[model samples]
Target chain A: MSEAALLHNSLMLGAILFAVGMVGMVVRRNMIVMFLCAEMMLQGVSVSLVAWGRFHNDFGGQMLVIFILTVAACEAGLGLALFVVLFHRSGNLDITYWQELREENQAAFMDREVPEEDREKTIWPQLTPSGVEPAANPEEELHRSRV
Target chain B: MLTANEHLIGSAVVAALGLWLMLPPSGERLRALGLVVAASGLGWLMSRMPGLGTWAADAAFWSLAAATSAAAVATVVSRNPVYSALWFALSLLGTAGVFALQGAQFLAVATIVVYAGAIVVTFLFVLMLAQPDGTAYYDRVGWGRVTSLLACACPAVIVGVLAMMLSSSLAGFEAGTATVAELAANVRHEEHVARLGGTLFTDHLVAVELAGTLLLVALVGAVAITAQDRQKTDARKTHGGGASR
Candidate 1:
């Protein structure tokens, strides 16, 4: 393809990716989802840089993208580790669990009303009770559920 | 001609409406409608890209770009975190294809390896530990009302403004053709990854070293942050017989 055509395509794709990521970052409540959105934004920028570099007829864009990959790897490692710690504290990945960390004067966010779900009985995979079904002790059953 | 201002504006509007509807806490009916609208909007935008260069490359670009954008939307909107992670991987692969099309062979492979191999696994491991039996409650819900209104509009604005900027940016520039020696003086004449690496080592070696150091620091930081009093778990292990605790 001609450089002009490629530039147009790459820039447009990058824009869409960045925009979608911004929306996801703002609206999604799960911390992992939020992190994924951030990475998506990075991908958008990388696409644009590559397009410019290609248009200019050099590998400069690729070089920058390599660095982006490095930083992203670091971000992934530390971010996921922190996520584990946060999950231990909140018992779930919901960002709302950390609302208390918001600026002291800011009012707590009122959650939007979710339309009621049908609450269908989801069929979860269960092992055939192989040993002392539910393990005699109720507390043991609780521990088993954690896995 | 395909990506004229009016066409871009129309696409941005349609996509914005779709995204607004898709954000959670809305009824499932609206989310379905949103999916159709958003897909069409993105499809129209992709069609606007002029693909006259060659048949085969155009075909690949069209298919890869479409898959990448669709997967991107799915990654954001899927209520199940596991499904989201899967969708994100598909998107990553599609992006890698785009990179390859643009002639960044090394970056493409690096993207697939570092992202599909590492980041997604970490996300899944975290999700496996944190998820309940089904979709979590928060995954089914979006942000509050005021936040939603503002957030949902951001993509449309960005797409529209970016479209205008791209058109303008193309006006004053021409593609440069660099000879091998021009790009990498020290390396032997070759194409693809060889040239990429030659440029890296000759010109940007310092940045590469710094990146390595950053990776090391981040590794140590992750380990330190996740470290805990091992004796606590050890003590529990002894008391509980350690079989399945």
Candidate 2:
């Protein structure tokens, strides 16, 4: 049980944690899961930071962790804000729904009945390239096409 | 070679056991067992060293920090945002321990208050508000992750190289030195608040004030961006409703 042994343990733990996070990030399909993976990665770095700080008897690493926490707070705030916006604009939280929101992209076969309320909030009408008159009830036109 | 720090050996063993219980129970159990055994051995060795109580304490702090960080990673990668946020808070607490070991008691407490208490609470708040759907999220963005990883690789390599060089240099200087102990003792004897205040005022005065101002501005911006006009939106969902609208 020497200093080297302690360090080796720290390194091993850090590596395993990092690998788990990476695998989760890669394999997970949910946005929330992806966020979790990113958090795991952040945790890995924090562990390394504390280990390095102790190994060298420096406070700089501690200070850096503080900064990282602040950045994480800000990131979570903005990310959730964006997620809310995406969810509201689209009926579903699925990423596939997001492609319709992407600028300059036309959905190949998304013709579906849109409720009047949904039509007001929808962005697809504005993106349509054809000169055809705007449907009196675009929701109905969308609904009819989908059927 | 028994030392004053021998008392810490017990706590170290307990901590190692806690870690073992925290890990996965499958193939990873062997690795966790190995870590616990190694930690126990390391604690025993530390007890045999003379005048190494502070070093032992510091090592313990680092071990806790690393464990917390690893836990955070596991949480994040679990595809459960709530779990990730939980690990993130644990990591913050571990950082507080590291700060305490570095003899910055105020900073340590502050780190916990700001990160574990405030920031993590906010993270949970956001998670609940966002209600991020997980099942179909990957179908959309999975292809782009590899590109992002490649983009991050160069910086990671550079950071890795820099850290190795720094660690080697510091190890060389600290190998057989008594100077650090004297310095640590002197700093402790002088009230930390006074020294830190004097240094901050005399040398880093502008930076300190700027940081304060920046924090204030950020606080205001967050409130403004998240705030909703009562006339425009329902009270129950003020923060997230605007984006959806």
Task: Give per-model TM-scores.
Answer: 0.81, 0.52
User: Lowest-lDDT window of 10 residues in candidate 1 chain B?
Assistant: B180-189
Sort candidate 2 into its docking category. incorrect
Candidate 1 shows a clash count of 0
**Candidate No. with top lDDT:** 1
For model 2, how does the per-residue alpha-carbon lDDT over B1-245 read when each residue is reduced to its tens digit?
Answer: 53333333433333333333333221345545645653554345333332323566546745774556455434533334566677766765765675555455655677688767876687677566666543233332333434334422432333334334433444553463334455354333357656555555666667656666666666665556555333345643665654535
In the order shown, the chain A TM-scores of the predictions are 0.71, 0.62
* Model 2 global lDDT (CA atoms, 0 to 1): 0.50
Comparing only chain B with the true structure, the TM-scores of all models are 0.83, 0.58
TM-score of 2: 0.52
lDDT of 1 at A44: 89
- Report the C-alpha lDDT of model 1 over A18-127, residue by residue, as the tens digit: 88888889888889999999999999889999888876666778899999999999999999988987886567888876766767799877545543333663346797
lDDT of 1: 0.80
